[model samples]
Target: MADKNTQVQLARQPDGEPKVSDFQVAETDIPAAGPGKFLARNIYLSLDPYMRGAISGRHMGHSRLNQGDLIGGRCVAQVIESKHAEYAEGDYIVIESGWQSYCVSDGAAKDGVRKIDPNAGPLSAALGVLGMPGLTAWAGVEKLADPGLGDTFVVTAAAGPVGGTAGQLAKAKGCRAVGIAGSDEKCRIVVEEYGFDACVNYKNDDWEEALKEACPDGIDVYFDNVGGPILDTITQQLNLYGKIILCGLVSQYNRNDDNDFAGHNMGPFVGKRAQLLGLVVYDYYDQMDEFLRAAVPLVKAGRLNFHEDRADRIEDAPAHFAKLMSGQNVGKAMVTIGPESL
Candidate 1:
């Protein structure tokens, strides 16, 4: 067994996009499992766009992750040792161990740790379609948006894990699912593989018009992932009493001022009486298993499709993170650290 652990920490706050120098990898003695606790080795670390908010020091989340802080994130880990009754040695679980080789936990909090069934699809899926992103999509599309049969459901960032999962859920519920993505390739995959009724490439010159044609009856349920001009375009076509699931604002996450958050006519919202609901995935963590129960089968049965852009080592997290923020990755971004236990 290794006596020392390697960890990645935030070296500096990013000005715009994060660079490798913004992080530092350090070595320290691995923590011993305390009473009611266990030591787990991290296998996979999830690199998400939301982490940008943390790295840039601009988020309102529970933790503010500053310089020299151990960068926190969700991971798939295997229990190496345990002093806790609930967990045994070699137990594969999902945990918030951040960018470290190992973590010690007692499984006390809702977001801290939870055991996962190896049979529940691929182990990496725990950090992607069957994990936080999955739960976020479920809470946004099912619990909040509630799209019904024949409803027009549109999602921005449609090729991403959250948006893709939500679009598929909308389709499963008998809605006409439409997606808006950055590139034509992403849009193609969203429509052809994810079963979205249509997908519009926002990078195209006539994207706004294309979106208008895609949602002929107007958007009944809009899952807003990127809050920018695209949101303004979608808002213009919102049906009466249209539901808006405000899941994320990726487009404006890097901005440093109040001006970036402004603009977009609100007249449509007033005339249509759209319901806008902001989402924080942690609020629905308790119901994650409910999401897993629904998504795992779809994934296993090949009804739902997911994508991943992976790095082979932990040292590659920052670069891949930059790729994710710049919209270079095609799907869920992740890093494989330790070998995945079967």
Candidate 2:
């Protein structure tokens, strides 16, 4: 077995989007677990847009990062050693293992760390389709937006993990799902792979007019993942009592120094009388079982589809993360820390 002390640390505060220089790889002596403690080795590190907020110390509820601190996020790992009764050696688990190769946890008592089924498709799926991103799409569309059959539903960042999943779920619910993405290729994938009724490329010159044309009946439900011009455009076409689920704001994540949305066009919000809501997937953890029960079958039966954009090594995390923030990645972006086999 490899030595357990190796780890990575946050090197500095990111100015705009994060760069490789902001991270520092380190090696330390692994500590033995005391009673009720366990040791885990990270296998897959999830690359998410929210991590961009965490890196900048701009998060609303939690305290921001201090310089040179360990940068942390969700990861799938295997327990290599265990002093805790609930966990055993060789158990595959999900935990807040950070960007490091190994982690120490106080078993199930810790905020993170749950045993995952190794038989489940790919281990990385725990961070993508079967994990937080998937749950976000399911819950946001089914419970929050409550899109009905034949309703015109719009989703921004449409080719991304959350947006793609949301579009599929909306279609499964019998709605006319419209996807808005940055590139023409992504727009095509959203329509062809995810079954979106229509896709609009936000990078196009007549994108706004195209969006208006696509949703002639007005948008009954809007899933806002990129909240700059896309949100502005969608709001303009919202129908009465339209539901808007706010998932993320990737359009502004790269602008860490700014505190203003002065450039946003907010004229549509006033006119539409739409309902806009911010969603954090963790708040609905209690519904995870319900989500899994519903989603697993669909995924197993091929009724639900998910895609992944992956970088090969842990060292590539910062770069891959930047791509996600820049809207350059389609579907869920992930970093492989060690060997590919789970």
**Cα deviation of 226 in candidate 2 (Å)?**
1.2
Local accuracy of candidate 2 as per-residue lDDT tens digits, 214-315: 888989999998887677777877998788898988778878675755476556776777888889887877887788788778778777777889887776
lDDT of 1 by residue, 1-342 (tens): 556788899888777767788888888899989999999999999988778776655666546567789988889999999999999998999998989888999898744788989899999998888988989999998899888899999998899899999999999999999999999889988988898999999889998899889989989999999988778778888899999999999988776553657777888788889899999897998898788888988999888889888998887888888788888889899999889864
Steric clash count of candidate 2: 0
In order of appearance, the predictions have TM-scores of: 0.95, 0.94
Off by over 4 Å in 1: 1-3, 258-260
- Number of clashing residue pairs, candidate 1: 0
Question: Residue 140 error for model 1, in Å?
Answer: 1.2
TM-score of 2: 0.94
Q: How accurate is candidate 2 locally (lDDT)?
A: 0.81
